[model samples]
Target: MPNLYFCIPKNDAVYFDEHEVTHMKVMRIKEGEIIDATDGNGGKYKVIVKEIGKNEAHGNVLNYEFVAPTDGRLVLFAPSGRWERLRWTIEKAVELGVDEIYVFNNEHASRHYDDKQEKLELIVREASKQCVRYHFPSIRSIEFLDIFSIAPESTYILDFKGRKIPKRISKSVGIIAGPEGGFSKKEIKLLKERFKSVCLGKKILRFETAVILSTGIFAMKLGKI
Candidate 1:
């Protein structure tokens, strides 16, 4: 497969952003070379590089394909913790086909890091490119209680004490993974009241481990993996 890049299409051409231009320079991509690109929506393109300027690269579209969006949404609700661990979780989640991610704060969270939206989005974008994903995932931070606004019936909490994952699930579903220290009693009570819970296994796992494992399992049930 040709190396995949990302661009926004305008008229019959596509313009690569600064990040992509830098990537092209690093890869020694030259004018007239054919490459694959996606708009991070559903459009994929075959393009011939036309020009590489100081800040951006331009290409002429040779062919275009539009992929239909996936059938269901797989949303992940993760707790805020160490930056390195959280970053790894985000990258792995995107590669595993998570549709959206929400990083939240809770009572038992080990540590709190200021939400750097730009850096987080950058990580998501790069992960999408690396995985050659046609549709990129959206991510943001939220408070623990904010989950109430989502469809509680379709949301699940990951806990070792909870029931095993169901063979079937709703088309749109969300999975919530607690922090390193686990959810406080009050938080657990509130969650059990509103959301269903699923167990990955008998053994406990780190927050990031739970996020990735639960995502892969749900994606498999959804036939996305």
Candidate 2:
């Protein structure tokens, strides 16, 4: 089987940048080999390697296929907590087929996110390619309360004190995972009023854990898993 790779779509072309070329070299892929690649926007391609250079490669697009978006989407609302914790959550959530992930400000968070949009975007791309997903999950950072502006079609706030989440849920679900230290009392009051509260279990979970469980359960409920 040909190895799978990812590329940024340029008009009707896909260019393998330095990072991708390095992987190609590691895989011993050479000129004349056919490889599968995704544009991360529902477009997949079969390319025949035409030329290779020290830091880049060119391919001839032989064929293309378009995959439709997933039926269910999780517009996850999570705190901008520890980078590693947030990264894990993002990678797993993308692998599980989350449609979108958004980070929000948390007053009690261990550390706030910095201006690392470039790095964060790369992480999402890699996670999508790692799982061979048909579409790239959208990731964004929003001001604390701005999250409500684009609230889910069906919003469910994941909390420890809420009722158990129902097995069957709406196809388009939005999940709100609390901060590391849990939401502030004032924040909780706002959340309760904005969304329907739902619980994952009796025990308390970490910020990242809550994201995983909440998104996973909702995705499974929609049979998107």
Candidate 3:
């Protein structure tokens, strides 16, 4: 497979952003080298590097292809936790083909990752490139109760007391994984009232583990994995 990078396409050319320019430098990509890049909106390009500057790289678009987005979106609702664990969850979630990721603050959330949207988006972009994904996932923070408005019927809450994940999910769905501290009774009651609850198995999982596990399960059910 060709190495993938992110780019901004001009009329007949593509420009690598500063971050990607830095990546190019680290990879020692030279002029005249052919590379693959994505616009992150389904457009993938085959480009020939023409110039490498201190802050940018310019390429001529040799070929372009548009990949249609996949069916049945998989959205993840994960609770705030330690930055390292949360970062891992985000990376794996993107690799697992999640369409959107929302970090929520709940009663039992151990830590608040406030004002980390930029970092989160960077992670999403890097993960997308790593996986050669033509379409990139969106990431943001949200209030815990705000989830109900974003596809309630298809959303599932991960909890030890919930039912086993079904063989298949027929529509776009969201999976919610609680914080490391677990859910409080009131929050659990509210969640139970709004979303279907599903369990990975009998054993309880850590916040990041549950997020990845439930995401993988949902991705498989949606035919993404």
Count the clashes in each prediction.
0, 0, 0
- How well is each residue in 76-149 modelled by candidate 3, as lDDT tens digits? 88788888888898899999999999999888777776688888889999999998889999898888778778
For residues 1-225, could you state the per-residue lDDT of candidate 2 as single tens digits?
Answer: 236788766666678988789879988998999989988889889998877798888787889999888786677776888888888888988877888888888677776555767677778888887888878888887767877787775888887788888767777888887777778888888888888888778897766677777787888887667
* Residue-level lDDT tens digits of model 1 in 43-114: 989999999998899999999999887889888887888888888988899888998888888887776544
Candidate 1 stretches with Cα past 4 Å from truth are: 108-115
Model 2 weakest 10-residue run by lDDT: 1-10
- Cα misplacement distance, residue 178 of candidate 3 (Å): 0.2
For model 1 the TM-score comes to: 0.91
- Distance (Å) between predicted and true CA of 84, model 1? 1.3
Residue pairs in clash, model 1: none
Model 2 Cα displacement at 41 (Å)?
A: 0.8
- Higher-lDDT candidate among 2 and 3? 3
My TM-score estimates for the predictions, one after another, are: 0.91, 0.90, 0.93
- Number of clashing pairs, model 1? 0
Arrange candidates, best TM-score first.
Answer: 3, 1, 2
> Pick by TM-score: which candidate is best?
3
